[model samples]
Target: MGGSLVGRIAAVALTIGSMVCARIALAEDPCLKQVFGRYCLGGEVDPLLQSVPAPAVSQAAADSLALIFPDGENQLYVLAFSRRIYKVVRAYGVSTQLRFDDTYRLLREKYGPGEDRSQFPEYASTPAARLAAIRRGEGRAVHQWMPSPTWHIELSWTRELGISLSYVANALSASRAARIESGL
Candidate 1:
């Protein structure tokens, strides 16, 4: 009986240790690790970002960003100018009912008041618009995919403080030749 109890405790401790390590690793964004609570500089993510601090985006504005995404197959991209973790691009067959803030606010409202920050040690307060995830592009070429709603949301950031976000949909077929560049 004594041996069995000891083994169980050991297993629980190992499990807890593993979970902590995984959490830290996931939280370990290169841009954030070096800065350590500093504001982020807008630019291609680099080693020097550690010295800068982060800024705050109001919940309303953050929520509103989601609205810009069009309905009925659209593309949406979020280029995090000041924060790299917030940057992402997703394009998919969007439903007409698709709206941005609906999903985000629910996460916030659930937390209630006086919630401890440590419980959600994540630096970015932004809520996912629609099951968001980090995606790698194919080589140097801008990556493309159909996550839902939009067709394409090309995203890139500068070393300064600018993130380019664009929404595109209902374009020519994929095999068709479509090549052009425009500025804002």
Candidate 2:
């Protein structure tokens, strides 16, 4: 009976330790600290719009609004649903392999190497070749990092979209989608 009691106490201690460790690991995830300019995921949209220069265009949908700002050689899109910002994207017009590589390196350095979801044909061996393939609609490059269950960041390049980095709040996005689906 004494040995069994000791073993039970050890098991409880182990469980508590694992819970604490899991919390610590979550707290240390750098992706949770991701932000777009001065805007953060799940932040109010009005404040962010006011802080930035007036957008070049604004479009309103049923449950969401999109603000597009032309910033230098890039375009910034802020998408808000139910007055809260859920997604932000920065699109680069001048897409180049070097530019994409530099951005990829910076993101990897900050958030660790994200899951590379790029689809390249076996024939596309070199970086330039891959870029050419992307331009020709033969392939696309995408890397994504999900820091937590609630948010993710994606960096992608394609012929039509060029190069873009997106920050998304998953929970809010899901809520928006549900609302749209139900015609609410």
Candidate 3:
């Protein structure tokens, strides 16, 4: 009877130790508390909007909104249901005098090298796959960073779209992100 009790206690201790190790691993994320400009991951949109200067309507979807900065350097997108900042897109344009290189340099300086930097031209078979691809920053070219399990930053360069930076929420379902991205 005493041997069985000791075994159960040992099992419980091992489980607790495993949980602690998992938490430590999660806490080690380099950019877990990092922010982009004035915004951070998982932040509410309304307050951020209120704090910043008014933005131009770059695009308005049925359930999402993309607001461009006055300087035309960046775009902010917010998801409807949660009203959270879902994506921050930076557009490179000669007229706006924006350069993707500067942004790339800044990101590297801030977060160091990303976890994955690759591109896959093949289209995904399903919406889920598409979202996964997007999350992985898989496209014509991709530079991706996962600051935390809940947030990701993807920098993609394509012939059609030029170079753009996207900060996405990983916790949200791929379907939901697809819907928001597509404005469906």
Candidate 4:
């Protein structure tokens, strides 16, 4: 009887220990504050490496969102999380204005200063959309966007219950993002 009690105690101890560890791991999850390129809180992004493959995302933070400017300028920024390359979420001719205060307001509206409540998993998303946007590369996530002349893209990912919510922000540069600003 004593042995059984000891065994039960051990099991309880272990269970408590495990629960603590899980909390610690979850606490480390990245959020919008960690917004940038590929960020992994628990696992890692496994590059297909079919071709040379963009360098093996050396560090989770190093993984980038490659933006091929309409000007034919291609820049890789640590703003993309990938199992593959990422694409700027765009709707052809929807040219977003680049205003600082307005951009901040948008962010405040979409996500407040803490864990967001509305970031639920999107189920109706098509397979391609899921494959394209969901967290990949060892649970790493990236936020993608394209600045419309006079703006630079910004991104964010915040966590709740160990999941990440990736989002984008368009803060304009002093110049324009496109010559035409309206086209496919």
Off by over 4 Å in 3: 1-34, 48-52, 72-81, 94-117, 120-139, 173-175, 178-184
TM-score on alpha carbons, each prediction? 0.24, 0.71, 0.52, 0.27
Question: Clashes per prediction?
Answer: 26, 0, 0, 20
Which residue pairs overlap in candidate 2's backbone?
Answer: none
Error of 2 at 130 (Å): 3.1
The Cα local distance difference test for each model comes to 0.32, 0.84, 0.59, 0.34
How far off is residue 99 in model 4, in Å?
23
Over 4 Å off, model 4:
31-184
Q: Tens-digit lDDT track for model 3 on 1-184?
A: 9999999999999999999999886654322233446554444556655655766554555545555664454444433224555566564543111454676678889889875565554676564554456446564456788776777888766554466777776764364667767766
| CA RMSD per model (angstroms) | 20.7, 9.4, 11.9, 17.8
lDDT score of residue 182 within candidate 1: 21
lDDT for model 2 = 0.84
Q: Worst ten-residue run, lDDT, model 2?
A: 28-37
- The lowest-lDDT stretch of 10 consecutive residues in candidate 4 is 171-180
Give the per-residue lDDT of model 4 (tens digit) for 15-120.
Answer: 9999999988765542322223443212222432232434433334333333322212222232334332222322112212233235445655654533222232
Specify the poorest-scoring 10-residue window by lDDT in model 1: 132-141
lDDT (Cα) of model 3: 0.59
Could you tell which candidate, 3 or 4, scores higher by TM-score?
A: 3
